[model samples]
Target: MSNGDEEGVLRVLVVITRGERGGAQVHVRDLLVGLQGRAALHLAVGEEGFLADEARTIGVPVHPIPALQREVAPRRDAAATRALLALARRIRPHLVHTHSTKAGLLGRLVARRLHLPAIHTAHSWSFSDGISWRRKAFAIPLEAAAGRWTDRFIAVSAADREVGLRYRVADDARVVVVHNGVADTSLRARPDRPGVPVLVMVARLAAPKDPLLLLQALEQVRAPCRLRLVGDGPDRGAVEDAVARLGIEDRVELLGTRRDIDAILADAQVGVLVSRQEGFPLVVLEAMRAGLPVVASDVGGVSEAVEHERTGLLVPRGDGEALRAALERLSADPGLRAAMGRAGRSAYEARFTVQRMVEGTAEVYADVARRHGLPALRRPQTPGRP
Candidate 1:
C-alpha cells in the first residue's frame, strides 16, 4: 500500500500573497484541489478572504502569513520573507511553487536561499497592469531579479509570456505556456433574456479591468442591451458614475460580487471582458463552458481563449467604437450568438477542462522533481539500521 511518502508522491509548498477574491487566488485554489493525493499540499497565503477558509474546508493545511500584503511595504515584505524561510525550515518542502507576483518574489527568494527547487506562475505581470512609470521601472527590475532566483516559470497564456519577454523579466528558456482551465460545471444553455440582451462582465472594477470602456461601448451600442457588471473593486464609484452619465442606469446592473455565477451565466447571451491586461481569464472559460458567445477586448490572453468569429468576437482594447460594434452585432443576431456559443462550448470541452489543467501542472511538478532529484519513498528503514 502506498502512502503520501510513496514513490513519485512529491511534497509541494504553494504560496500566494493574498487570499483576495481574484483570478490568481482562484488559480491557486483550483490547482491545489486538482493536485490533491498526487502531491502532499501545503498552502501559504495572506489573511484576506475565502481562500484560506475554503482551502481549510477541503482539508488542505493553511498557513496565513500576516506580513504578506498585496501592496508593497518593504518592512512587511522583509518580515514575510523571514516568515517564509522559517516555514520552509519547519515544513521542509521538496519544491516551492508560487502564484501571484508578490508571493512569487518572496517564495523564490526563500527557496533559492534554502537551495531547493522552485517555480513561479505568472497569473499576470504586475508591471504590465497599467501602473505608474516610476512603479513600472522599479517593478520590472525586481521581476528580473526574481526570475533569476527561480528555476522555471509557468505562464497561463502566451500573452503573459510575451509581456515577460518584452520587458526582459524572464529568460526565454525558462518559461512555459500553460493556458488556464476551468471545470465543466455548465448549466443548460440559457434562452436569451426577454426584453433585452444581457451581456455579462465578470471582472473587478479596477483600472486594469476597465469597466468604463464597456459602459462607453454600451452607450454607443444601438441594440437595446443590459450590461451586468459582476464583481467589485476600488474603481466601483467611477464605474457607477459612468453608468449614470452614459444614461445606462436602467440598462446596467451592478452586481457587486456574486456567488451565483452559474445562474448569472445561464441568464446571459454573451460575455464581455474589457481588462487592459489579463492572463488567460477564467471568466471567459466559464462563459465558454456555459455556452455563451463572448465579446471581449483583444487583450492579454483573451485571443487564445476566444476564437475570433467562431466562439466570440474580439475587439480592440479600449476602442469604444470597436467594442460597441461587436456587442451590438451579437445583440442583433440570435443565430450568430447561438452558433458562437455552441462553438465555444465545444472548444471548452476540447481543451479547457480542469482535468487537462491538472495534468499539465502535474507534468511541470514532475519535471521539477526530476531536475531536483526528489527523494523517492524507500521502504521503512529497519529499526536501528545504520
Candidate 2:
C-alpha cells in the first residue's frame, strides 16, 4: 500500500460500476460528501450520470472507466480490469473501496494485483432473497471467487451480511454491517392538510422495485388517496399503462426524478416503497428524516430501519391485500400517521444519521489501513462541535 498523503490523510480510491441515480449511487455520493476533508477521495465510476455529477460538484476527482459496465462482457471486463489497474497505479491510493457487484469484482482484483487492501460495500447481493434463481446461480460462485481477493466486506444491512455468509462469500469475521444513512430532513415537517391523503413512493420504476405493486394496492385502497410515483426507469411505460388500465390515472401522478424529495415528502401524508428486494434503502431513512411514516415491503434490512406499527407498517412483499390494508389504515387515521412519523423521526436521529454512517465507514477504513501497515486515518470532526 502506498503511504498516504504527507499529512497522513488516507488516499482512498472509491469504485462503483455505474454513476446512475439509484440506491448504490446515492450511497456513494453521500459517502463521498461525508468523507470530504477527512480523507483524500477519488472516484472511478462507469457512465456519466448523477453520481459523477455530484462527485465533481463536491470537488472529488472523478475518473471515467468506459469499459466498466454492469453487463457481463468478457472483452469489456478484461479491458475494465486493465484500465482500473492503470488508474490504481497512477493514483497510488493507500486503499481501494469498491461498491456494487461489478466494480467490487474488478476493483478487488486490481487491489490484489497491486497488493493494496480492498474494502467492498455490498449494496445488495445479486443472490439475495427475491432475486431470480438464474441470477443467484451466476452470482454465488462469482462472489465466492471475489471474496478471496477482498480484505473486508461492508454489508449495508445485517441481513445482507447473513446472505454473504450463507453463500460463503465471506466468513462471519470479515463482514460488517454498516446501515445506510442520509442527511436529516426532519425540520421539513409534514403539513397538516384536509384534502385526500397523498402516498408517495420514491423508487425506480424497475424490476425488484415493484412500483406497479404499489399502484395495484393503491387501487384497492377504499379511502380516497393520490399516489405519487417519484422515479424513472425502463418500466415507466409499463407503470403508465398500469395506471391507465387500473383506471386510476386521475389519482396517480408520475413525478419522474425530482431533486426536491424533502419538499415533496413535506407535502405528503405518507412515504411508501414496495420492492421485491432491497438493502437498507436510503429513501426509507430520507422519509424518516422528513418525519413521514413509511410503508415498505419487508425485505432485505428494511425491518432494521422500519419498526412495524411504530415507525411505520411493513407488509409482505407482493401481497397486495396486506399492502392495501397498511396504506388504508395509515390514510384513514391522521393521528396514527402523525404519531408514527414522530417515532420514525426519532429513529432516524438515533441510528440513521449521516454522521453515524460516515463515522462507521471511516472507522472501517482506519482498521483496514492499520492491518495493511498504513498510517491511521484522521478522524472526521463532528459537524456542529467546536
Candidate 3:
C-alpha cells in the first residue's frame, strides 16, 4: 500500500454515494478543486452524473461502482463492497474519505479491510431527529458500528456532531465540526425592480425539503412576491401539482437545475429553504455569498449560518403561517433586506469561504496521518500552484 511517490504527497481516495447535483456532491466537487495542488486526489462515485463529470473535468481520476446506490439492497451492497475493496487495493491510497451514507458505510468497510485509515464526512445522518423512526432504528446501531472503524468523523456542523455524540456513533474526540463552505460569488449590484419582489429557493424538490409547504405559504403571502424553485428531484411532479392546486402557478416558476445560480441569485431579493432536516446546507452559504438575505426553516445547523434578526429570519419547520409572515415582513422592507443582505455577505466572507473549509479538512487529514505514523501531509508553498 505504498503511495509510490518519493515526495511523500498524501494520496486520498474520496468516495460518495451519488453523483447528482445535491449539496453533498457539490461539497465533494469543491473539495477536490480546492485540494488540487495540496494532495493526490481520486474519486469513486456510485453513478455517472454531475459530480463524476465535474471531477473528471477537473482531472481527478473517476472510479465508477455501479452497485453503489442510495437504496438498501443486500445484493447490491455486497457487490458494491467488493467493487470498492478491489478499487482500494488497486489505488492503495494513503487514506480513504467518504461522503453521504451509502459511500460512508461501504467505503469505511473497504478501508478497514485494506488496513487504511478511514475518514467519513456525514453530510446528514440518517438517524437525525426529523428522519423516519424506522430509518433511525436501523441507522443508529449501524452508524455506531461503523464509527469504530472510522479514524475521524467530519460533521458539517456542531449540531451534526452533537447528533453523532448523542447516538454514540463516535466519541467527541474522534468527531470534528467543519462547516460547509462555498466559493465566493462576485456580487452584482441589483437595480431597483418595482413590480414584484422575487424569492428564490435553491434545493432539490424532494422529501425533507418541503417545496409544497413553501407553495402553501406562497398562497397566503400578502406581499406581491414571486417564487422561483431551482433544482429538480423525485418530488417535482408533486410540487407542480401543489403549485397548480394552490392556484399560484403565475407566482411560481420551476427552473430545474441550472449552472447559473449566481446570476439567478443576483436578480433575486431573498433566498429560502424549508427542509425537515439539514446539516448546514451549502445553498444557504451560496445565498450569503450572493448577498441575499435568507428565510430558511429553523432546522439542523441553519441557525449556525443565519443569525436570527441579523442576516435573515428563521421560521418554524412546516409552519406555513410563520413562513408567510417572515416572507411578507422581508418583502415589505427594502431597507431591512439590504441591511440583512450586507450582513449575510459579511458572514460569508468571515466564516464560510472555500479556502477555510479546504484548510480545515486538510488539517484533519494531517492529524489522521500523524496519529497513524504516516508521512506528513503538506500544502504546496506557492499559492494557486495548480
Candidate 4:
C-alpha cells in the first residue's frame, strides 16, 4: 500500500454509489469523520449526490464518478466498475470499505481483483419484502458471489445479520455487528408546552416512510394534535395532497430540510417514525437524546432501538388504529411521555455516541489489517522495530 512503510498507517478508500440525504449516507459520513487523523482517507462517490457536497465541505478528497447511479443499467455499471478499478490502481489503498448495495458489489469486486483488503457494510439488505421476488432472487446469488471478495462483513443490525447469514454472505466468523451512531450534538431540551399535542415526524417523504398513514392516524386521534413533517423528497407533493384531502392542512405543517432539528424536537411533545422498515434509524436516537417521547412503527431495526413502553411506544406497522391509539395515549398522559422520554435519553447515553462507534470501527480496522498481514501499530519505541 502507498500509505506508509507497513507500520499500520493504512490508506482507506471509501466508495459509495449515491450519497443522498439518507440514513446510510449520514452514517457513512459520520464514520469518515471519526476516522479523520487516523488514516489517509479518500472518497470516490457519485458525481451528483448530496454526499459529494457534504464530503467536500468536510475536506475529503472526493473523485466524482458520474456513472455510479442507483439504477441498474449494465453499461453504466460496467463503466463505474472500471472507474473504481482504475482509481484503486492509482490510489493503492491498503483498505477499501464500501457502504450501500451498489457500491458494495462493484467496489469489492474491484478491490479484490487488485489484491487489496476490503470490507462491506450493508446499512440494510436491499432485497426484502415489498420489492419484487425477481429482484430478491437475483440479489441472493449476486451478494453471495460478492461475499467471496469481501474480508469483513458489517451489518448495522442483528436482523440484517440474519439476512446476511441466509444469503450466505456471512457465515459467523466473517460477520460483525456495528450499531450506527450519531454526533454528540447538544440537543436543546424540549421547551415547556401549553397548547395542543405536537407530534414531530422526521423522514424522507417516501412511500416506504408512509407519511400519508401518519395523516390517517392523526385524523383518528380523539385528542387535538398538530403534526410537523420534517424532510423533503419526491413524495412531498403527494403528502401535501393527502393533507389537503383530509382537510387537516391547517393542523399539519411541512417543514422541509431544516438543519435546526434539535430546535424542532425542542418544541414538540412527541417524536414519531412510521417507516415500513428501518435499519436502526438515527432520528430515533436523536429524538431520544432530545428527550421527546417516541411513538414509532414496529419494523426492522426500530424494535432494537426503542424499548417499547419504557423508552417509546411501538405500534404494529401500517395499523392506523393502533397508531392513533398510541399517539392519543401518550398525548393525554404527560407523565407517561416524560417517563419514556427520560428512559430513551438514558439509552442514548449508554449505547449510541460518536466516541463508542469510533472505537468499535477503529478496532475492526485494526483487526482487518492484521488479518491481511499489515504491520502492527507502532509505538514511539525507545529505538525501533521488534
Candidate 5:
C-alpha cells in the first residue's frame, strides 16, 4: 500500500472504464500527472486500449477489468462488480475515485459494499432528453441507483447537477460542481484566410453529437464557407449521407481524428457543436484556447462553456435555422468573430487550466481518504527535493 518514500503518503486509487485518449480520459491523465509522487496512484481500467499504454508510459500502475461493459447487461454488471471487489480487497486503497458511467456505478457499488469511501465524476449525462424515452428511463434509474453508493458526485456543469437533482439521483449536499479545465497555453489564434470563412466542429462522431444538424444548417447558410468536422465515431456514415443528400459534400470535410486540433482551431474563424447534450465539452475549451468563436447548441452544460453574444453564440438544440443564422452572422462579420474569439480566450484563461483541475481533484482524494481512514501523504515528485 505504501508506494511513497519513508514519509507517510496517501494511497489513492482512480478507477475508469477505459483510458482512451478522449475528453474524460485526457482529464484524468492530466490529474494523475499532478498527483504523481504525491499519492500512490493506481488506475483501475476496463479492458486494455489506448489509455493502458499511455498510463504505463507515465509509470502509473494499471489493472485491467474486462467485465465492464458500456451497455446494461445484468450478468456483465454482476461480474464487473465481483472483479472490482476482488481488486479493492487486494489494493485496499484509502479512497476510490471513478470516472464515466459504467466505471462509476460498478466501482462505487463495490466500494460501498467494502465500506470504502467513493467518489464519481459525471463527465456528461447519458440520459439527456435528446435520447429515446426508453434509453432515458433505463439510464435515469441506473444512475439514481448508483448515486446512493457514492460518497460524493462531481459534475462538470451546473446543468448536469440540476439533472441529477431533478431525477432524485444526488442531493445538493453530495453533489459538487467542478468545471472542466484545460491549459490556457494551448490556445493559438489562426491567421485569417482570404475568401470564405472556415468553421470547425470537434467531437466524437457519435449519435448524440448530431453532426448532420450542422450539415443541414449549411444548406440554409447564405455566406460562402467550409465546415470542418473533426473526430471519428459510429455515426460517420449518417453524417456523410446527410452531407451528400444536402449537396453540400464539397463544402463539408470529414477530417477524422486529426492530431493538429490546435492548428485547426488556429486557422478556423468559428467553432460549432450541435450535440443533443454536452457535459462541459473539452473541444469548446480548446476552441476558446485557440481564440476561435463558438456557436454551440444550448444543451446540458453547454451554456457554461459558451456565453451568449460574448464568448460565443448559443442556438437552440436541434434548431437548424438558428444555427444557420448564427454561422452566417459570424461568417459575414470578421470584426464580430474577432471580438467574440477574444472574449472566449479570456474566459478560458480565467476559468480553465490544467493546474486548477489537478489541484481540485487532489483535494477530493485527500477528503475521501480522511473520511475512510486510509493512509495519507505522498512524497513530492518535483525534481529538486524528494
Candidate 6:
C-alpha cells in the first residue's frame, strides 16, 4: 500500500476466451464493474460474444480477438496469443490478468515473455471434471508449465487451490483462494406453485454439467415431481433423448436458455445441479439467493456452497442413487426444504455477496502490485464502489 511501488502507473488487462453466460464470464463482468475507478482497466475477450457485449455496455474498453475461442484450434489459438501479445505491447500494461484455462496459459506465457507480472484466476482447473485420460494427460502438464510463470494464482474455491498444489501446478505460497461472489438479483413472486414440487437446474446442457444423471434420479423418485432445465448447450439433444428414454417426458420440461432466471427460481421449490466438475458456480448462488434449497454434486467448490444436511444436500458426482435419494428426501418434506432455503439465504448474505468478492479481489490486486514493486496503491477514484 504505502511503500516502494506506490507512484508508478499500473494498468490491468483481463482476458477470457469464451464470453458466453457461464460462471467465469459472469465473474469477469462483475470483477471489472466492481474494480471500476480502482485502476486503469481493460478487457480482451472472444470477439462479439456476451462477455464483450456486456463489458462494453458497462463502459470498459474491450479488445476483441477473433482467434480467442473455446474450441482448441492450434493455428487460431496461436493467432490469439500473438494478438494478445501485440495488444499487450501496445497497451504496455503493468499487469496481465487472465481467466479460465486456455487464456491463463497463453496470456501468462505472453506476459512472462514481455517481462511483465501476471495474475491468473482459476475459474476452474482445466483438467478438472470427467474429461478423457488422454486430454487430462496433456492438460495437466501444460497447466503445470503455465503455473510456473504465473506470479499469483487465484483459486475460486479451496478445492481448486488444492488441485493446483496437488499437481504442483504452483506452490502453496503463490496460490490464494477467493470464493466467487453474487449480487442481489431482483426477485419476482412465484405464483405457479404446482401441487407436485418442482425442481430447477440452471446450467448449460453439456457433459460436464451431467444433466443426464439428474434425469436418471428423477426416474427413481417415489413421489411425483417435475424438473425444469433452464439452460441449453451441445448436450441438449442427448439430454432430451435421456428424458424420453427414462419415460419422464411428462414430468421433465426443458425450458432452454432463460434470461428471466430469478423469476424462474421464484417458481421452483427446489434447485439441483449435477455437474461432474465446477468451481464456485453462480447458478448455485442464484438458487440460494432465491431462497431455494440446493441438491448439487459435491465436487469442486460445491461443498463450500451447500452444507450437507444443512443448507442443502450434496451428492457424490454422477451417483444417480444418491441424487435420487436426496431429491426424494427434499420433495417429501416441505418443512425441511423451507428450513434449508432459509439457511441458504442466510449463508449467501453472510459470505457470498458481490461486495465481498470485489473487496477480496482488490486485495489480491494490491498484493500483486506490492509483490511486483509496481506502484504505491491508490484509494479508489470513486468514493463508494460496491
What lDDT score is found at residue 183 in candidate 4?
A: 69
Local accuracy of candidate 2 as per-residue lDDT tens digits, 1-386: 11244356688999999887888888888888888777888999988989999988887889999999999999999999999999999978899999989999999999999999999999989899999999999999989998998888999999999999998999988898899988774355562357788889888888889988888888988887898989898999999999999999889999999888878888898999999999889989988888889999999999999999999999998999999999999889888888999999989989998878888998899888888888676656556310
Which ranges of candidate 5 are over 4 A from the true structure?
1-7, 191-193, 377-386
What's the number of clashes in each of the models?
0, 0, 0, 0, 7, 4
Q: All models: lDDT?
A: 0.83, 0.88, 0.88, 0.80, 0.81, 0.84
Worst 10 residues of 4 by lDDT: 377-386
Which pairs of residues have clashing backbones in candidate 5? 9-376, 9-377, 9-378, 10-377, 19-51, 187-289, 190-266
RMSD (CA, Å), candidate 4 to true, equals 4.4
My TM-score estimates for the predictions, one after another, are 0.92, 0.96, 0.96, 0.92, 0.92, 0.93
Q: Estimate, for each residue in 51-138, the C-alpha lDDT of model 6 and write its tens digit.
A: 7888777677889888988778899989999999899998777899999888888899899899888899988787766556788788
**Which candidate, 2 or 4, has the higher TM-score?**
2
* Model 2 per-residue lDDT at 153: 94
User: How does model 5 score by TM-score?
Assistant: 0.92
In model 4, what is the error at residue 252, expressed in angstroms? Answer: 1.1
lDDT, candidate 2, equals: 0.88
Worst 10 residues of 3 by lDDT: 377-386
lDDT of 1 by residue, 11-78 (tens): 77899987866777777777777776567778899785868876776667888899988788999999
Greater-lDDT candidate between 1 and 2 = 2
Residue clash pairs of candidate 3: none
- Please give the ranking of all candidate structures by lDDT, highest first, separated by commas: 2, 3, 6, 1, 5, 4
Q: Candidate 5: RMSD over Cα atoms? A: 2.8
Off by over 4 Å in 1: 1-8, 129-133, 191-195, 375-386
> Taking the tens digit of each residue's C-alpha lDDT, what string does model 4 give over 1-386?
12343244678889888766778777777776676556767889986567777766666678888888878899999999999988988877888999888999999999888888889988777764445578888887888888998889887778788878876776898888888877665654452266687899989998579899999988878777889999999899999999999889878999998768878887888999997877678888788888877999887778888998898899987899999999889878877888888888888889877666666777778899889876443322231110
